[model samples]
Target: MLARIFINRPVLACVFSIVILLLGGISAGLLPVAEYPEVTPPIVRVTAYYPGANALVLADTVAAPIEQQVNGVEKMLYMTSQSNNDGSYTLDVTFAIGTNTNMAQVLVQNRVAIAEPSLPDVVRAIGVTTKKRAADILLAISLDSDVNPATGKPYYDALYMSNFATIQLKDAVSRLEGVGDVFIMGQQDYSMRVWLDPDKLASRNLTVTEVIKVLREQNVQVAAGQVGQPPASRGQDFQYTLSTLGRLIEPKQFDDIVLNTDKNGEITYLKDVSRNTLGAKSEDIMSRLDRRASSGVAVYLLPGANALDTADGIKAKMRELEPRFPPGLKYAIVYDTTPFVRESVHEVQKTLLDAIILVTIVILVFLQDWRSLLLPVIGVLVSLVGTFAVMKVMGFTLNNLTLFGLVLAIGIVVDDAIVVLENIERWMEKGLAAREATMKAMEEITGPIVAITLVLSSVLLPSTALGGLVGQFFRQFAVTISVSMLISAVNAMTMTPALAVLFFRNRKPGKHAEDKEALPWWGFGLLGGLATVWLLTPILGPSLGLTTGEGHGESAPGGLGASLAGLGATLVLAFPGAVGGGVLGWFMVRPVNWTLGFFFRGFNWVFDWATRVYGQIVGWCLRFSAVVLFVYVGLIVLTGFGFSRIPTGFIPMQDKGYLVTNIQLPDSASLERTLEVTDAVEKIALETPGVAHTLCLPG
Candidate 1:
């Protein structure tokens, strides 16, 4: 048929370069070396509290019945609530983009358990907040110490490395494996400060709620209930006994316990009045660069892990626990996203090795021979070693947008081996011999090189049905430029016509009658289609930087002049951005469809019964082409209920960097006058010239 594959061109280029180096070593050992891709977003939060109510009575008793039962869950989008007369209440929410924060946390814990028997049991806890990126923070810590460097330490400490990188390394990187949470600001957690004496509690008539019930029932521990095993005579399995004794470690054990007694067995203690002090609790803390005090650890990277191998195994376990710290405590990890995904996968492997050494020096200065530059550099390394062995058997990873779509398909993967080696050097200058010029150049370009590599691999096959997160980042850059241009059009049809019938025979067709009167067939197909219309006329005519005297002059176009200047700039900029955004959106679509047609004419009789159920889905799309392809796959499975009615986000919060600053003061402000209003807001963030550095954390 195709003239028996060049009658053994070096055993078909050594069995298609050993089956493309065994599928490019199994797609470079199965792809997935990610840093980011599998996204969920659609956030959630909730929270609650209330004890001494206030933020307008805890936002009308616990954030309005938990935001009216999570405002009808699915893709809610905006919720935001917050109250704080120091008796908090939250809300947050934010769904939409394929919302499913684990089924929106079981529909917000069954709509906060149907408004928990109408809340108000002095509401205490609610919490939800997940929207996983393993709950954000893919690594941040940054510590370096030597403290008392004669007590200087001033080197702009990013909020003491963001609160000792989240409370001394986020509870051991939130116990590692795909860590979900580890947020820490600058520093916090160490409290105890009771300074009572109001005239010795008015000569011991004691009150402040009886010194907060003798310091929370002498630092609580209670258990008692359960001491059964003794009545076990017949039916076995009995060991029911639970006992516990209390012990409040220190602060003079709340001035020696015993509270109400006096009926005769008198003993009302607590140093009879009060004074407990032990300090260091809540008020943002994050310290590192030797100023000791630490807390800042943002490790998150779990959903289908691998963010640079979980941030290089958490910086090699923080340099193997930096000698179990203590010598002026230390830790260091400035920031990571694995060095911006290894500098964008080493800048697309230096732009795919400078576009394969500038397309092998412009095909050896325009095929000046050497077997037309070793049969198109062994047919572009056997079509990128069989497109990295089908991206290591479809595991796929060499990221940075699938290695920038395999270095922008290295000149459209050598345009059908430069059009079947310029049509077997025009049939070896017309006298054809080397196996009849490779069987008349594969029967005159085998059906336009298999219909231009199946219409350029069917233009990224609708980006693998792109569902969410921009179809998991352009479905691995459209399956690495559609399987490396379908393995460079099957190595330009069987290893460049079996290495051009064994290394381009005669190979002396360079100046045949001054290159056949300087190229004839419509003057070399109108100078190879006007160098693919001046290499795709700067995306369809404009930048006339046209200097094609060929070779490396005003460089750009290559093989088949970059596939007809990228298919005439993708049909001249996608047919004028889809017919000019559909005719400037039809003259502002009749006053925006009469302002959303008066809220969609109140669902126009349920959209006229969904247009008579899509007119029985266009009469079953022609009396059933498999029931119009199962009603076009039930309208693509009702596009997952129109993508769960759209509105979800976990990251993408851009109210510019961040600054919460609340300052108030009065509640017994001490800690050195609340660190002098946190050193005058860190001197107005070092005199803000577009600030970029600030640290005054205490809340």
Candidate 2:
């Protein structure tokens, strides 16, 4: 009935399909592209630093209090903490998939606040930070220097480069849209150092503690009062504020600070006991690029952000800032994940194209008519492209899983169209007009198409109910295929029947235009046998005492006469076998034809041959119904057994176009020793096959 309405009003059917195409085209542009759907659980990290504290001390003082309070927060799956020997502590709180990272961060921050009072004063003063961040690194930008134009030497040292990235690049990148955070790896901040002389301190009767007390007291802000008072002076025209030296900024100012005065008109200054200079806060870490001093700035992506878009924005921002960089300073995005994502998406797109072409070719071969082929090809395009609209509505991405689903759906989506088209052609061959044939065909297939669509959707839709990362990975894939199938069924019921009516012509009994049924089954078997023998003769001829008379050379018969004789002898031996085998194979296949003709009396020969073979197999099973059912049950049991025995994982390991290597040294190893080990490792890695570059960061 639905097909009849569309068959009468073909314009309405065409309009319906065109609307789907337009919406799908627009949705394809809007949907985010990714290598995979979001499968990583949301994470909130807590970081704190305690200067001069060992790993053991940090574990006892900083980690314990925080973990105790932060554990078992809302939606939390698990939490892990690491206390490093360098007095740094990190706690990662992993929440269940689909949890809002912002809410998870707030909950963790609240817990951390409750533990703050129990922490040591020094650790508390240094401060603890809580923020939501992804565990995966999106990009790693490196800064290095070339020859300086002014001095003909490297423009900046390690400390200057590290601090420059911290001051200039880190905040700029962090403020970019879709960026979660930025970190300056192996960073060193400037601080004034006072190298105290114990001998000078003994001579002055001052201890290290006394000198530290004086420094703290003197190196502070002085809030001096106003110079003019408005309340007392009636004639005062202006109020002047006083300015005084605040915190010391230079080593020279620290050197001149007073420490103590002796008994007889003498004074002690800080310079009397200690030497001071501006230096890095700590020299415990070092970073390098290609054995040159460098600084690394790692950019993190926010949860649910588009990775390709975020990476593009970062690169664009860097290019905009390149001109303002100091002479000889340059930045490179040494490590990026976007290229892999882009290439993978492109590869899937190619596969999808290949699938469409292949499905078209197969339909053309089977239908044997270009006019008939167009219907299924159009159905495939409409079903696949229209699925994108549903994907956008459901918040699905154009990722590997969904694309793979589309590639598989190509074969499936073409089935409904082909079924309707074949049935309509059958009715036309029975002398019915095109419109009447379309109505009759739709009456037969409409129920079967709906049933197939429902069956397929029911099978795939349940995967969406699976829990955790597995569900996230497969949900889009399942839904994409299911939507395509539903669209295909709709097209079969509407556009397919309408197009058939418009494209096909009426045929009278015994006057069909196409001659697809002229060849008999026996003729096909004979030709097939002859072709098989022709192919195998070259290789099996010599083994079967049949040759081309080559080895005899001059002594043997030569020229066309000899070749004809040899060919005649070979045919004489092969003809009888070919004919006998062909006749025997035809007899064996006759039952299949009989079974097919019984069910589909008026269909074309090719369709009948295919359907009859399948029907004969089913007939055989029906004859041995008990044995067939037993075998089927046994196969189901075997499948269950095999599935349970196979090794399983959330996702297979992939070569992501780069590798990460982490090196650790002995607990008591100094930074210099760590650098030595890293240098050796870097050299070995460079010598190994397939390694393009190496970055070493020792801390």
Candidate 3:
């Protein structure tokens, strides 16, 4: 009944297809592109610092208290802590896969507050910092200074570069949409340092405790009151406010601080026993870009955020601040993970296009008519494109898994159209008119089409019910394939019959004269032109790097000449094969029909032979049903054994076109020694084949 209505109203059927295409196209643009869905567990990190404390002391005083408080937070899957020798304690509390990251953080924060009073006084004073962020590092931005022409050294040192990025760049980037947090590697905030001379202090009979007390007292902030005449006894009223320097901003101010006064009326100043200077808070960590002193800013993506868009926003923000950068200072994106994503998506898109083209050619060949090919081609477009709308509604992204499903669906979706079209064609061959054949075909095959769609969808939909990260990974894939299948079934019932009625003709048998027509000269010209460009691209396209140069007195296989020769050979063979076979039928008309006829006859013969063999096997299986069942059971058992032996993982490992190497040294290793080791590592990495760039962060 649905097919009958659409067969009569061909325009309405086309409108339905157009609507699907429009919705799919729009949804595709709006869908976020990613390498994978959010499979990593949500993590909330608690970090704290304790100056002059070793890893063991930090573990006891800081890590223990925080972990104890945060251990059993709601939805928390597990917790891990690291206490570094540099007085840094980091605790990562991981929640279940789908837990709300913000809620987890709040819960962890509430627990930490209860444990704060039990922590050391210094730790409480320093305060613990909590952050919610994805575990992956989206990208890294490096800030380096240019060489000084006069001295042949960097105009700015690593300390200056690190502080500059922390002050100017970090906050701005953190404010951007989709950016969870920004961290400055090798951070060095400016601080006033007092170099106390024990000898001089001993000579003056001033203890270190006395010096600290005087320094703290002198640097304290004072809130001076206003001087007003509001309540003064009659006469001129004048109001004034008094101001005083609260905290010392310069090192010289600390030098004049009075330390102690003795009975002899002798006063000693802080400058007498100590020297003051402004320097970095810590000089333990150093960053380098290609062996030059630099700072690295690592950016993290928020949970469920689009990484490509966030990376672009970070880059644009950097460009906007480029003009304000200090002289000789510049920034570069040293490491980014988005390029792999972008390239993977592009490759999938190419594969999708190739699949569409291959499907169309196969349909044209099997149908033996250009007009008949439109049924399946249109069916594929509508079904696959419409799946995007379903994906958008399901909160799925255009990631690798979903795209893989789409690629597989191309074959599945085309099946519905072929089934309907073949049924209608069979009716037409039996001396029925186009409309009558379509209506009769729909009446007979509509149930089968609907059943096939449901069966395929049911087979895949069960995967969506899986648990945990594996479920998240396969859910989108299953949904995508099933949605496309459903849409294809609808298209087969409605559009396939309508298009067949419109595209087919009502002709008596043996009317070959009217079907045969002259081939257009322009069609041959277009094919020839395309073939010429395709053949010449290997030779003339320098971007292809197809050089005809000799290496070690041997001709390069990938050279232009060899590439062109190979291309020519492929075209010669393929033109007579599947793809070009259709082209020849389109352009050569009756002249090439004989050749196509002979090739197709051979194909039909092989297909028939295979069908006969399959029929014989089916008959044998029925005759020996018990034996066949036993063999099937044995095969199932074998499959289970093989599956148990195979390695299992959440996802296959992909080379993402980059590598990360973590180098650890002994706890007693000096900063210089760490740098020496890192320098050696960086040099080796740079010299390694396929290594394009390297960034070093040594502490």
Instruction: Give a tens-digit lDDT track for model 1, residues 217-332.
Output: 66777876664565557766667668665756567776776666666787777667667766544343334322233445556665445565456556656767767655655655
Error of 1 at 154 (Å): 15
> Where's the lowest-lDDT run of ten residues in candidate 3?
550-559
- Assess every candidate by TM-score: 0.35, 0.76, 0.78
From the highest lDDT down, the ranking of the candidates is: 2, 3, 1
**Local distance difference test, per candidate?**
0.61, 0.82, 0.81
| lDDT of candidate 1 at residue 583, scale 0 to 100 | 57
Give the candidate order by descending TM-score: 3, 2, 1
lDDT of 3 by residue, 1-699 (tens): 888889889899999989998888777766776898778999998889887688899988888878888988899999989987767788889999889888998999999998898789878988988889889899999998999999999999888888889989999999987888898888777877899999999999989888878877888888787777467566647777788988897988988889989899999888999999988777778788887789999999888777766777787788899999989899888888887887787789889989998998788667655566777888999999999988888778889889999999999999998888888777777878878888888999999999998999899999999998889888899999999999999999988888888777644423332442223333354466456556654655333443322221111242235445655654443342444534654667666555656666687789889999999999999999999999999999999999999998866798877777899999779889998999999998888998767888888
Tens-digit per-residue lDDT, 322-361, candidate 2: 8989978998777888777877887999999998988876
Better by TM-score, candidate 2 or 1: 2
